[model samples]
Target: MSKALGYKSFGGSDVQEFFSRPDLTPSPVEVLVQVAAAGVNPADHKLRSGEAPDLNGHLPFPQVLGLEAAGTVLAVGAEVTGLAVGDRVTGFALTGAGTYAETTLLLGAATARIPDALPETWAATIPVAGTTALDVLDQLDLPAGSSVLVNGIGGGVGIAVAQIARDRGLVVTGTAGTAKRDLVTSTGASFVDYTGGDVVERLRALAPEGFDAAVDTVGGPSLHEIAGLAKVLVSVGDQSVTELGGATVERRVDRSGLERVAELMVTGRLDPHITATYPLAQADEALALVESKHATGKVVIDLRL
Candidate 1:
C-alpha cells in the first residue's frame, strides 16, 4: 500500500487526513512515480474547501490533495516514451491521482526530467508556480523596459513573476503585505504596502506615467483597485478579472514549459525560494500555512524529511 494525504469529502482543513491505498498503475499516456516532494498551493485548499467544482465530474471518496510533484520514475506505461525507470522527473499529477502520495501517476506529456543540480523540493514547485509565471509573462508580451505592476507579489507565482520580469528587463513595482516587503524588494522591484491606505496614490508615485502592464495575483477588491493601472492586465488568482477588461492567465502545462523553467533555474535566473518543507506525514501542517495566506514563498512536502 502507498501512503497518501486526502479528504473523503469536500469541506475545510478539518477534513484532511492521511490514508493508505494500493499503488497506482500507469495508463498508456502516464508514468508511475515514487513521489519525493510535493508542492502546497492555494489551489489545494480551495479544492478541498469545495470552492472549485470537481473537474473529473465525480469525487472519488478520499480525493487526493496535491497537483504537482517531483520524484523518481518507478515504471512507465507501455506507450510511454522519453522516460525510463529510475529517471528523476517533475510533473502534474493525473486527475484523481494527486502528488500528495508515496506513489502517483503523472501524465507523460506534462512530465519533464529534472536537471541534476536542481533539488526535488525546488523542482516540485516548478510545474505550477514556475509555469504560471512563464505563461502569464508570455501572454503579456511586454517590451523591454516596460513598467509593470505585480499586484500581490509575495506568493510563489508572484515571486517567480518578479524575478522573471527583472530578467526580461521590465521595471517592476510590486504590492505586497509589509511582512513580505523584504522578499518583494530583493527581486529588485519597488515595493508598495497594500495594507497601507490609498494604494493607488502610492502606485502613482512609483510610476507617474502609469504602468504599461499589470499582473494580479490577488483577486477580489484588490484586483478591482489595480485593474485600471495598466493597459494590459492579467489575473492568476481570479477569473472575475475578465469582467473588468482583464483576462485570466494563459496556462501551458507541458514538458516543454517545465524544461524551460528547469533551464532558467540552472542558469540562476529563477529561484523557487521554497521557504518551508515538511514530511509527507505533516502535509496538513504545510497546507495549513499556505491556506492561511502566511507562507512567505513556497511550501513543500518532502518525503525524505
Candidate 2:
C-alpha cells in the first residue's frame, strides 16, 4: 500500500486526511514512480477551498490533491518509449491519481527526463507554474526589446515569466513586495515595488508611455489598477483584471508550453527556483507558505523517499 494525502472535508487546513492506499501498478499508459518531491501551489488551495471554478463535482471528499512532482520512474508501462525504468523525471499527474502520494502512477507523456544536475526538489518546482508561465508569455507576443510590466513577480511562475520574457529580448520590468525584491530582480528584471501605495504613479514616472505588454499573475482590483498602463495583459487568474485594467487578457497558450519551457531550461535561459521545502508529513505547512500569498519562490514538499 502507499501513503497518500486525501481530504475528507472541504475548506481550511483540516480538509486533508493522510491515509494509505493499495500500491498502484502502472497501466500501459502509466509509469510507476517513487515521488521525490511535490510542489505546493495557490491553485491547490483554491481548489481545496471550493474557490476554483472547475469543481463541478469532478473530485469529492477524501480526494487526493496535487498536480506536479519530481520522481524516479521505478517502472515504465508497456507501449511506452523514450522512457525506461530508473529514469529521473518530473511531471504533472492527473492520470496517476495525484502527486501527494509516497508512490504514484503518472501519465507517460506528462513525465519528462529531469536534468541529472538538478536536484529532485528543484525539478519538482518546474512543471505546473513553469508551464503556465511559458503559456502566458507565448501568447503575449512580446517582441525583442519590447518593454513589459509583470505584476506578481514573487513566486515561481512570476520569476519564470520575467526570465522568459527577458530571454525573448523584452525589457522586462516586474512588481514584488520589498522582501521579495531581490528574488524578482534575480530573474534579471527591473523591479517594481507595489507594496507602496503609489506604484502605478512610480511606473508612470519611469515609463510614461506605458509598457508594450504586461502579465498579471496576481489577480485583484490592484492588478486592474496597474494594468491600465499596459498595452496587452496576460493572465492565469481572474479575467476581470484585463477588462478593468484596459489591457487585453488571455487565459493561456496550450499543452505544448511544458515541452517548450523544458527546452529553455535545458538551454540555461530559465532555471527553477526552490524557496523552501518541508517534509512529506509537513505538506500542509508547505501549502500554507505558498497559500499565504507571500512566497518569494516556489514552496516544495520533499517526499524524501
Candidate 3:
C-alpha cells in the first residue's frame, strides 16, 4: 500500500484526507514512479473543488492531487520506450495516477529524463509552469527586440515566461503586485505593479505603440484590460481569450519539449524560482498557499524530505 493525500470527494480542503491505497500499476505506455517531488498549482485545488469536472468527473472517488512530479522510475509498461526502471525522470501524472503519493504513473511519451545537475524540486515544476511558458511564447513567436507583456508575471508560469522571453531577446515587461516586484524584475522584465494605479495607463506609458505580444496568466477583467496592449495574445487557462481576438495556449506535451526545457534548466537559461516547499505531510499547507492565488514563483511538495 502507498500513503497518499487525496480528496474523498470534490469540495474544499475539508474533503481532503490522507489514505492508503494499492501501489499504482502502470498501463501500457505508462511508467510507475516513486515520487521524489511534486509541483503544486492552482489547478490542484480547482480539480478538488469540482471546478474542472471535465478533468476529474469520470475518475473514481478519492482522486489524488497534483499534475506534475519528478522521481525515479520503478517500473515501465510494455509499450514504453527510451526509459527503464531506476531512471530519474520528470513528467505528467496523466493516468489519474496522481503524484501526491509515494507512487504514481507517468505517461511514457510525456516523460523525460532529468539532467544530472538539476534538482528534483526544480524539475518537478517543469511539466506545467515551464512547459506552459514555452508554449505561450512559442504561440507568440515574436522576433528579437519585439516588446512582450506578461500579465500576472509573479506566478509560476508567468515568472517562467518572463525569463524565457528575455532569453529569446524579446523586451519583456510584466504586471504584478507590489509584493512580487523583485521577483518579476529578477527576470529582467520591467515590472508594473497592477495594484499601484491605473494599469492600462501604466502599460500604455511603457509601450505607446502596444506590445508585440502578451501572455496572460491572470484572467477576467484583468485579461480584458491588457488584451488591447498587445497585438498577439495567448492565455494559459482562459478559453474566453478567443472572445477578445486572442487564443488559448497551445500545449505541446511530449518528451522532446520536456527535454528542451530540461536542457534550458541545465544550461542556466531558465529557472522555476521555486519559493516554497512542503513535505507530503504538509501538502495541504503547500496547496493552500498556491490556491490563495498570491503565491510568488513555484510551490512544490518535496517528498524527499
Best by lDDT: 3
lDDT, ranked from best to worst: 3, 1, 2
lDDT (CA) for every model shown?
A: 0.91, 0.77, 0.92
Better of 2 and 3 by TM-score: 3
Q: Model 3 residue 102 lDDT?
A: 88
Q: What shift in Å separates residue 152 of candidate 2 from its native position after superposition? A: 0.4
Find the candidate with the highest TM-score and give its number. Answer: 3
- The parts of candidate 3 lying over 4 Å away from their true place are none
Better of 1 and 3 by TM-score: 3
Q: What is the lDDT of residue 279 in candidate 3?
A: 97
Q: TM-score: which is higher, 1 or 2?
A: 1
Put down candidate 2 lDDT per residue, 218-248, tens digits, no spaces.
Answer: 8887686776788777666775764665433
lDDT of 1 by residue, 69-104 (tens): 999999998887899999999999965678889999
Encode model 3's per-residue lDDT on 73-170: one tens digit a residue. Answer: 99999999999999999999972568889899999999999989999999999999999999888888888999999999999999999988988999
Which has the higher lDDT value, candidate number 1 or candidate number 3?
A: 3
Per-prediction CA RMSD (Å): 1.0, 2.6, 0.9
User: After TM-score superposition, what is the CA distance of residue 253 in candidate 3 from its true location, in Å?
Assistant: 1.2
Candidate 2 deviant stretches above 4 angstroms: 53-56, 77-79, 241-256
